[model samples]
Target: MLRLLFVGDVYGKPGRRVLAAQLPLLRPDFDFIVVNGENAAGGYGLNRESFDLITGAGADAVTLGNHAWHHKDITALLNDPRLIRPLNLPPGTPGRGAHTFEVSGVRLTVVNLLGRVFMDAAHNPFLAMDELLAQPDLGTVFVDFHAEATSEKAALAWYLDGRVAAVIGTHTHVATADSRILPNGTAFQTDAGFTGPLHSIIGADPDGPIQKFVTERPHRFSVKDGPAELNGVKLELEGGQAVRIERYHYEEGGDGSAAS
Candidate 1:
């Protein structure tokens, strides 16, 4: 069996801090580590420094979401094979959205796809996935479906059942309660959730979102402070099939509070 740790969206300084502190204790238990860091930079987009923070904290590969290109310099980083953006992005999009890595004699391929429902315009994730899976034998395929709609995420999971090892959702910041193996052997979760301040609204200061909601206007958002938390999933795969998918949660300062 091979174990992989997939961390949900990292919000900002709080997320990175908790991750750096907790990963050292968690690393020994997993064979591979992947983190979603699209919002790592000031809770908007990933900058070079924030990217380094995530990788430095122990991410083998970093997956991104709709905020993938918020940082202008990230354009240059599109060439880095370890950084993956959404595959459904236009053909000319700077970064590639899928990558394969070999670990401990086992090959694992990770793909990122963005959902069109309630999201920015993008190609069809189902068709894009079909093209990727059509390639000869992509060993132990795992997908990070960065999407908003729960229905869309679940539909894709069922669409690719047995064809991939796991399909975990992101972008919603709130982790879903559903985590189980599909009828066809695929491990599925609606959303992996966010790994950052838990007191605020989805890692941002609650005031901004609340005010915006009341006024129906844009407001400058900022990363929230206070108690931080780390949310993620641990997958146990046997022979390129997911046999177990479990949620992993950790609180800042190690006082021990499960992710809510």
Candidate 2:
């Protein structure tokens, strides 16, 4: 059996802090860890510092989303083998969208893909995945579908059922209750939620989003700082098929004590 942990989008210093604090506690239980750190740098995009911090916190692979290139210096960091960007980006785009890691003698392929609905234009994820799976030697596959719409996420998961070990969604910053194994033995979740200030609006200060909503104008948003929470999913796979999947949630108190 292989146990895998997939962490949701980590939003800023708060997210980083909680991740750093909790991973050590959770590390021993899982064979591999994957984190979504696209918003790790000031809640905009990842930077080298954020990348190192996440990796140092026991993440075997770090995944990105639509904001994968928000940081001016991120282009260079994308070349790191442990970092994965959206695979459906235009050809010739820097960084790979998929990476393989070996743990306990088992090879796991992690793929990151962006959704096109209500998001920036990108190559068709379905076709991109088809091309990727056609390549030889892909072991027990797992996907982080960073998308805006739940339907899109679900569609892709169903489309790829039985072919991959699991499909977990990100970018929504809200955990959905629907987490279960598909009929074909693939684990699926609408969204894994996010790691950041629990009280804020999707990891950002509520003031900025509220102003934009009320005034109908662009407003700058910053990462919210306060008690934090970490959200993710735990999966157990046997023979490249998911046997179990459970949502994991942890909240931190002001004094930094964590509660599950």
Candidate 3:
């Protein structure tokens, strides 16, 4: 069996600090670790420094979401072979959507995909995935479906059932309770939540989202600091079938958000 650890969206500095503190304690149990780092830089886009912080905190590879290129510098850094963006992005986009790694003598392919429901335009993820699977199987496969809709994530999981080992969701920042193995043996989840401040609205200061909803006015939101939360899932894959899936959350000792 191969053990995989996938952490949800790492918001910003708080998320990075939590990972730095928690991963070392959790590292002994997993063979491979993947982290969604789209918002690791000030909760907007990831820069090279944030990328290094995530990888430095024990991430074997970092996956990105729609904000993959929020920082212009990321375009140059995407080709580093460890950072990945959405596979369904337009052709000629910088960086790869899928990455292959060797862990404990087993080859694993991790693919990042963006969902189109109420999201920015992207290629058909299902069709793109079909094309990817058309190639010879490289190794155990996993996907990070960074989407907003649960139905889309579920549909993709069912579409790839029995083909990949797992389809883990990200971008929602709120962990769902539907962690289960599908009929075809692929492990699935709607969202993996987030690793950042728990005292905010999905890692941002709640005031901004609240005001935007209440007053219908644009307001700048900043990543909250203090009392970081780490959310993720641990999976056991055997023969390309997920045998077990578990969700986990860790929080620093505190309750309130730190002053901005």
Pick by lDDT: which candidate is best?
Answer: 2
Candidate with the larger lDDT of 1 and 2: 2
lDDT of 3 by residue, 173-200 (tens): 9999999999999999999999998899
Task: For model 1, give the 10-residue run with minimal summed lDDT.
Answer: 251-260
Model 3: clashing residue pairs?
none
Query: What does the lDDT read for residue 233 in candidate 2?
Result: 99
lDDT of model number 3: 0.90
Deviation (Å) of 98 in candidate 3: 0.5
The TM-score of predicted model 3 comes to 0.96
Q: Looking at candidate 1, what is the lDDT of residue 52?
A: 84
**Global lDDT for candidate 1?**
0.89
lDDT of 2 at 64: 96
Rank all candidate structures by their TM-score, best first, as comma-separated numbers.
2, 3, 1
The order of the candidates by lDDT, greatest first, is 2, 3, 1
